[model samples]
Target: MTKTHEGYFFEDYRVGQVVRHAVPRTVGAGERALYHALYPARHALYSSDSFAQACGLSAAPLDDLIAFHTVFGKTVPDISLNARANLGYAEGRWLAPVWPGDTLTASSEVIGLKQNSNAQTGVVWVRTTGRNQRDEAVLSYVRWVMVRKRNPEAAAPEPVVPELSDAVDPRDLVVPAGLDFGSYDFDLAGEPHRLGDYAVGETIDHVDGVTVEEAEHMMATRLWQNTAKVHFDATQREDGRRLIYGGHVISMARALSFNGLANAQMIVGLNGGAHASPCFAGDTIRAWSEVLDRAETGAPGVGAIRLRLVATKERGGGLRGADGKYLPHVLLDLDYWALMPI
Candidate 1:
């Protein structure tokens, strides 16, 4: 009898399978402290209790990416333990604020599956939901990964690709209750830009960069409890180097955006995101954002803005080339809607 556990492979998933991930985490101030220490995150709503209260929150909530990384960590053992790459994300939404002392768990349902033509790997799409202890869903998103097959000769499963939206509908964005930014303090927020100050088709070069370090990247991944081997095990890849988690790049880019978008406080919806290239320890990440659209919400002093946030190793390289593929320097391309003071 054997009592060891390996992980799922390409041939092991079905279109309707559901996986309830284990090891629920209780997040609080400690997570917030470590996150700030790891990255140059200075978002006001996530930094000070008083600042959050002034904006109508009970207190400062954890950084939205902290919630995302914590929840994403729990799903690693089940969904991506043997993944070759985490491809993309879609239809993500932050439904509620995750406060200190909140316990979070995650579950995922396999919504789409397609075996690659090479037969050695396949794409598995899952809709994952992270819920707080009270059974209230705090976050939800669809992510797909490429998984290696345990048996290369296994027959391919029937392909069932999901129909995903190109972008989140602004009307579907959820604004936190009592999040009134009408009396927002421009000085405190560090940027004078407001909801009305930004126009559609405008672009902002954040004009900053941070070089990722091996120690910091590893520490950040471990802080989130992400146990994927490629991020930590140098032997897993051909070059004998650790791969930085894609989420790390995303958070780094978001933190850099604070220079020009300090008031884009809460990320309410994640329409789409693609990790265009692999980031190593020494890559210096820079960010830029283009205002896609804006809308008024029913909540007083709250509005939504859709923006495309791009992370690149070098500046001034267009996101896409003439061939319609991502440029070599582009590391990440994310589209989302965030709440700002009107």
Candidate 2:
């Protein structure tokens, strides 16, 4: 019988140690369709095979976050199995666009570690890289997590924390080569908003909702290779409900913003994001976006827009708000940056 790898202890990791995660996935039209249905993504290149071919891609590729999830999911056994909290991510970049039928694999190198003062926990940092079948780098990021030590009395390991970039510079943003929205169909893309129309500090209420389902989430998690037990196995959860992946909600909200924020492009900064409330199979997910800031990137024909995406559930036959905050129906609060046509 093949033994299942539960996870590793804090004592097991060492600087320079490399951990390769298993299971590569091939994205397909179903995932693409689900992405559009879940969020409202209208990027012409990703929405239509014909349009993608015009942009030089053989077919519509998977969304960027899909690639991130596929890569990040691989590290769960090596990184977050016993984690108390995900500290942060830095220097994250998407190098190459991933297409359907492309296989994605990932590995992470232990970069640094710090034994916490409490002794029961320590912080571990790793630089994770995702590569496609051809061995080209797809995405990379540095992330740290607070991991609980099995034994508080264990001897402390050498403390090391590598310095990471605060944000990927705007000039460093890579636009998909040959991408041209000049002949893009605004109506078919689901929005008429253009890069020149949006003003700074504008808030757009994306008027769409999707009630997530257990089967849908399981399919998504498995598709990403995110084998987090709680997200799939009902027996592992106390309430007998499958916990949805946080990133799923994030992508859903980001896609929903497409209605009025279609030009919002590459996600440059993930300042702060949260799954504010637990979402279940029957809870309908609705999203709204607030334009937080805007700036010009050095990249030709591209600009950066910062946005806050809020998702909520329907209650009492209508969406409800509690005081100044989103009601318990609120599912997510995400702050991030995106590159857009200018």
Candidate 3:
């Protein structure tokens, strides 16, 4: 028997199947250093231990996306190795802070699947949870991907589409234990705007753009341990262009939003997100955010703000066109809830 292990294809998944991903990672200050180097991330809660302590966390935890990318990388071989595209995300929540020296592992359950009419591709939906060494869940989310089939003639499985919510419920959000914003420092946080300063229906333009560098994208993907061929091998696509990983775009946009949303410290919920268009090297990424909603939380001196964060290659393009599809310039549209000082 051959020792080489090939990745799974469309027909390899079934509803209710559980996959325990391999290679748990221990995250620490090094990941934070690399993250700041990779993106212009300067959120004070993640930058200083004292600021986090003043906010009631024992220490500054890792950036939320660090935990996301690490866990996501673990599921790639099992869920998206042969994928044509990672379609969308929904119902994501950070259950607890991933402190320094915490080891994380991931597992996924196949919840839904449907074959495409083209017969060469199918969509697989899975709910993945990332846990610490103590087996306490730190993050959870649902994502669907389009995977290619090994044989076009193979029979299709019964379609089972999961009923997902449009957004995460505000009442269901989990605030990290001991997290209190009562003593938050606006001067140190870099923004004076509190949760009350932002109004529903208000939009803020984050007036900065970063052009994508081929080397940086590759390094970022490799840092996540993602080995998807399309991200590194040009021969995988007919256009001879490498598709920048969507997570890269998300991080870039989130970092850019720091100018206007510096106090939106912790991302507690990811209601939904879509990769509106594929990004390639040399694209200049710009971002904007619109306040969607607000809610009160039991956490002392903390409130929740729902936001629609949009990333685009160019400025001034409306999110949708007359046909009700995303404009060509749009790269990513994400909806999430964050904690801010009240």
Candidate 4:
């Protein structure tokens, strides 16, 4: 039977529980084109069949975050169905690059649980994993959420919180084997920036906008198999408009940041993020980025760049204000990492 409700409560979870989320996905060329048009991403390995072939791949692989969202979205039904808040995410690592036409699926296992002293709420932690049709592990991460207890009179469960790392170690970052950018085309990659050019604290304002549409959001959410009613059923929303998937804004902003941060590769961490405001159809989204931090990894020929990307809807003709507060036109506040050429 299909379980309805997201934002699961504290009383509903137990340690050792495994929730297998439904709906698998098959990636294709359309998604590849969208990745290019959406972000200005021209990584030779992802953009050219010839370049990819030289490196021994059939074609460019899907962006890493695409694999992440596909995996994360599956756990929503069982894990977040009744959540009060998404506490945090840690230990996110991309294990393998996913090629187009590959089918993927995901599942989550509850690792810990804690009941609040108030007896009305508690916390649930889960480790989620994604795999391809071949059953190769593609991505994994840990997340926790605040959930309400159905019965306030019930005794609180013993608290158990798993220790997590502050940041994923650079040594742990996995590079796709046989990835030889030696034959990379600077022109076709869409920019002249290379691994050596970006500074640790530089920011870029990706100057483009895309007017969102209901059909577009629906198609995207359904494509990820994300069935949140608010994102799809207009009637379920108070404003009588479908809520754009937060991931859509994330993708748009990440893609736009490529203009100046083209060499930033492979998101290795998802420290935190927020959908500051609801994005609706017809809202034109634009993006800007701030370099939060940078670290030299032990990996040869690679560095890690952390960025904060903000997506906003243009108010008439110009970008919105900068009080660090999202205007009604704002859509997302994202913080993450990317691997860059050294």
Model 4 weakest lDDT span, ten residues long: 315-324
Candidates ranked, most accurate by TM-score first: 3, 1, 2, 4
lDDT of candidate 1 over 1-342, digit per residue (tens): 878658899999999999999999999999999999988999999999999999889999999999999999999988999999999999999999999999999999999999998999999999999999999999999999999999999999999999999988888888888888878898999988888999999999999999999999999999989999999999999999999999999999999999999999989999999999999998999999999999998888899999999999987858999999999999999999999888
Span of ten consecutive residues with least summed lDDT in model 2? 315-324
TM-score of 1: 0.99
Q: Scored by CA lDDT, what does every candidate get?
A: 0.94, 0.73, 0.95, 0.73
Candidates' TM-scores? 0.99, 0.81, 0.99, 0.81
Q: Which stretches of candidate 4 lie over 4 Å from their true place?
A: 1-9, 33-44, 54-58, 83-88, 112-123, 146-156, 235-241, 294-300, 314-330
For residues 1-342, could you state the per-residue lDDT of candidate 2 as single tens digits? 859776776777898999988777666667677766655567665677886665445767687887888788888877877665566666777778888778889999999999989888899999999999999988888878778788788888988889876556656656566655555555665667656677766767878877888877777777666766668777866789877877777777777777777766456555555555777788787788777767676545556776777887763222235455445777777666776666
Give the clash total for candidate 1.
0
- lDDT digits (tens) for residues 169-259 of candidate 4: 6667676766555554566656777666766567677887778777777776766677565776768756798777777777777767777
| Candidate 4 lDDT (Cα, 0 to 1) | 0.73
lDDT by residue (1-342, candidate 3, tens digit) is 998757889999999999999889999999999999999999999999999999888899999999999999999989998999999999999998998899999999999999999999999999999999999999999999999999999999999999999999999999989989998899999989999999999999999999999999999999898888899999999999999999999999999999999999999999999999999999999999999999989999999999999999987857999999999999999999999989
Pairs of colliding residues, candidate 3: none
Ranking, lDDT, top scorer first: 3, 1, 2, 4
Number of residue pairs clashing in candidate 4, backbone atoms closer than 3 angstroms, sequence gap of 3 or more or interchain: 14
Model 1: how far residue 6 lies from native, Å: 1.7
Q: After superposition, how far is residue 88 of candidate 4 from its true place, in Å?
A: 4.2
| Poorest 10 consecutive residues by lDDT, candidate 1 | 1-10
Please give the clash total of every predicted structure, in order: 0, 2, 0, 14
